[model samples]
Target: MEITRSRDFTAERAWGAKDIANMNGITTRLHWTDQPYRWHVNDGEEVFVVLDGQVEMRYRSPEGERSQLLEVGDIFFASVGTEHIACPIGEARVLVVEKEGSV
Candidate 1:
C-alpha cells in the first residue's frame, strides 16, 4: 500500500502535482501551489479539496462571475463545462480528482 502526508508535500513550481492514484479514466492528485490557475472549463467533472491553507475559487456562470473562499477541509465541485479558477491565499496543498489528462 502507499501512503502520503499531504502537509509534508511541496513542489518547485506553482500547481506542481504528485500523482496519487488512477482508476479507469480518472486521476487523483496532490497539488502544491502558491499562484493562481487559469480559468478554464474541464471536459468532465472535477472534485477539488483543500488540504491546507486557503484558496479563493472563482467561477463564471449564467448569472455572472462569482467567487468563494475555500478553507482547509473544504471541497469544491465543478461540473462539466463549468468555468473556474483557483487562487491560493498563500502556500496551499490541494487534492484534485478528475478525468485523466485533464488540465
Candidate 2:
C-alpha cells in the first residue's frame, strides 16, 4: 500500500514500519485525559508539536529536572535516554513527532 504525507493529525502508519524516504519525523496524537506516555529512546532526535489543547511535559535527569505546559503550536524535544512523562490538561490534544532512530 501507498501512504501520502499529511499535515493534520498523525497519519496512521503500519506498525513497526519505516518510511522509505527520509524519516524527518513521525506524527501521532495523545488523546484527551490520557495516561502518562512512555516512549522509547531513539538514536535520532525527537519532538512533539502541540496541534491542539494543553499538555504538560515533565522530564527528569540526574543532573536536573524540568516541567512545562504546552499549548497549540508548542513544540518539545526529548533528549537521548531521557525518561519523562506527559499529561494533558483540560481536554488536551497533541501531535507527537519522532525522528527515525531518534526518540
Candidate 3:
C-alpha cells in the first residue's frame, strides 16, 4: 500500500504533479500550483478535486465565459472538449483524475 499527505507536497513550479496511479486507461495525479493554467480543453473528461487552499475555475460556456470559486473539498468536473482554466488563489494542492496522456 502507498500513502500520501497532500499537506507535505510541494513543487518548484506551478502545476507540477506527482503521478499517483493508473487504473485501466485512467490516471490519477496530485498537483501543486500557485499560478494559473492556460485555457484549454482536455482530450477526455477530467475530475478535479481541491485538496487544499482555494481556486477560481474559469470556463467558456455557450452563453459566454464564466468562473466559479472552488474551495477546499470542492470538486470540479470537466467533460471532454470543455474549455477551462484553473487559477489558484494562492498555493494549492489538487487531485486530478483523467484519461492517461490527456492534456
Candidate 4:
C-alpha cells in the first residue's frame, strides 16, 4: 500500500483547470473570471464542489445544451464521457474530485 501525505503535493494547471494528484485520484481547482470553458467527452466522471463563488455548467447534446447554476457550497457531478462546459457567474473557484482514468 502507499500513502501520499498532504505536504507532498503541489498544484499544476492545464486547459482551465489546476490539478493535483496521488495514486488513487486527481483533484482540480478551477477558476473563472468572465470566460467560459469547454470540455469534450472523456473516460472518467468528475465531481465538483463550488468553493468560493458561482458558476454555470452547460451540458451539450444533439438538440441543444442544458445548464445548471452552482453557488458557493453547491455540489454537482458530471457523468463519465460527457461533453460539457462551465463559466463563472461571478468570479468563482471550484474543487473537482475525480478518479484516475482517461477523463
By lDDT, who's the top model here? 1
Q: Each model's number of backbone clashes? A: 0, 4, 0, 0
lDDT of 3 by residue, 32-68 (tens): 9999999999999999999999999999999999999
lDDT for model 2, please: 0.57
On residues 1-103, what C-alpha lDDT tens digit does candidate 2 reach at each position?
Answer: 5553322323242122223344435544333343455534556556766656667888887877778898888988876677777766644455455654443
Residue 77 of model 4, lDDT score:
80
69-96: candidate 1 lDDT, tens digit per residue = 9999999999999999999999999999
For the record, the alpha-carbon RMSD of candidate 4 to the native fold, in angstroms, is: 5.5
Q: TM-score of the candidate numbered 3? A: 0.98
Question: Candidate 4: where is the Cα deviation over 4 Å?
Answer: 1-23, 28-34, 61-63, 100-103
TM per prediction: 0.98, 0.57, 0.98, 0.64
- RMSD values for the candidates in order, in angstroms, are 0.5, 5.9, 0.5, 5.5
Cα lDDT of candidate 1 equals 0.98
- The stretch of ten residues in a row with the least summed lDDT in candidate 3 is 6-15
Global lDDT of each model?
A: 0.98, 0.57, 0.97, 0.63
Clashing pairs in 4: none
Residue pairs clashing, model 1: none
